[model samples]
Target: MSFITLNITCSEEKRELLIAELSLFPFDAFEETETGLLISCEEADWEEEPVFAVLARYEVECRVERVEKVNWNEEWEKNYDPVIVEDQCIVRATFHEPRPDFPYEIIITPKMSFGTGHHATTYQVLKHQLQLDHKGKKVLDVGCGTGALAIMAHKRGATDITAVDIDEWCIENSEENFSLNGCDHVKLSLGGIETVQENDPFDIILANINKNVLLDQIGAYSERLKNKGTLVLSGFYTEDIADLMAEAGKFGLVHQEQTERNRWAMLALKKE
Candidate 1:
């Protein structure tokens, strides 16, 4: 499907507010421009009502356009760069040279998928993954964009891994990436949490989806995790910690630690 782009010029304060509101909708990616925020999504999912409703609250200039027949990977290649997390992990594309120095390297061709280890949420999660133990363990990666987290778990020695996402493009892109990283054995599902066929509870669960999605799926996460298993989460601001922790607590998931970067937070919890 084609993609629609919205170029919104609003005040600095309003920029973030718009992002938060638009994120709740079907928008795929948001980029900050010199004038405002540039948001895009599949044309099939684009709705003018929500976009205009949010824009109506503030005084701003908005431009809507259709990007015809664009390839997500090509678009990404033109504007993307490699990301380094904690100086230990390097996320680079095939076009970039290898960095043999870093202990762990995740090569990604994100396409239309997220989680290139560039966003603060993704970076924080990957950094947290480095600190966790995955050796000979089973891992579940919810909202597995680009399959980065699952591949990292493999690099860290996870024996069995399952990754799930609701987007078909993401599932396709992630498969390419997993094969590129030599972890194609990682199972991938093309739907939400319910599509995950977890006959055995996981030892570690990684979820970097937004707050609302995380809240809705926390119970499922709880049921899928083995006792004392770890759950690492991100994709919400630092302030959302209380709400997330509260939801997790409802299912006996105890908060053990947290890390914040540029206002985005990653919380690690253990199932009790």
Candidate 2:
């Protein structure tokens, strides 16, 4: 199926805000470029009036342009590259070179969207995953885009691990990556936390989804977590931490640790 590509070039101060705003839409995929942002949704006619309204809120000037239809999958694979973080892990495109030095390797074909691990949310989870004692423990990675963290946990010694994402492409890419990294035991599933019914009472639950999603499912994590289990959450700005903490407290979860990079934040909590 063909898709519409919306290209918007705005100022640096407004780029992040615009991206966050666009995320509310169900875009097939999106990318942030040096000059602006590019968004793709199933072929549709976008009224510039609404876009202009959104821009006015931020007082940012934007220029829109149309580009030729292209195969987004092929383009993403061609542009995707292995991203190494903290010299301990590597997030690579299936088509690129792999580095053995990274104890954990995640093979992700970004496709229309997802993966890349450059986002602070993914990086935060990756960093905290290193600090976990996954030695033969059962782990669950909810919203496992590209399965980067799930693969890492397996490599780190978590024998039974499951990675779930709503995107079918992400599930497919993650499976290919699991095999590529010699981590075949890790299960990849579609859907949200509901797929976790097959496996329950996990020793650790890792969720790096947005704030709203996290809050909605916070109870599910608490219910499925083994006593004394750990829950690591990211994908929200630092300012939103307070609200998360409040909600988590209701689930008997207390903040144990936190890490921040750029404007993103990660919180580690333990179930009482």
Q: TM-score: which candidate is best?
A: 2
In model 2, which regions exceed 4 Å deviation? 1-27, 32-36, 41-74, 77-81
Clashes of 1: 0
**lDDT tens readout by residue for model 1, 1-272:** 68898878876446556766788889877655446676788899999997798898787899898986655455455556788888899998888889999999999985556777767788888989999999999999998988999999999999999998987878998999999999968988888888775578999999998899999999998889999999999988889999999899899999899998878899999999
Cα lDDT computed for each candidate against the true fold = 0.85, 0.77
Candidate 2 CA-lDDT value:
0.77
> Per-residue alpha-carbon lDDT of model 2 for 1-272, expressed as tens digits?
55666666665335556766766666656765444566676556554566668878877656554555666656555444466778888887766776777776777655433445766778778878877899999999898776778888887899889889997877887787678778788887889997678346899999988899999999999988988999999888899999999999998999899988777899999999
- Top-scoring candidate (lDDT): 1
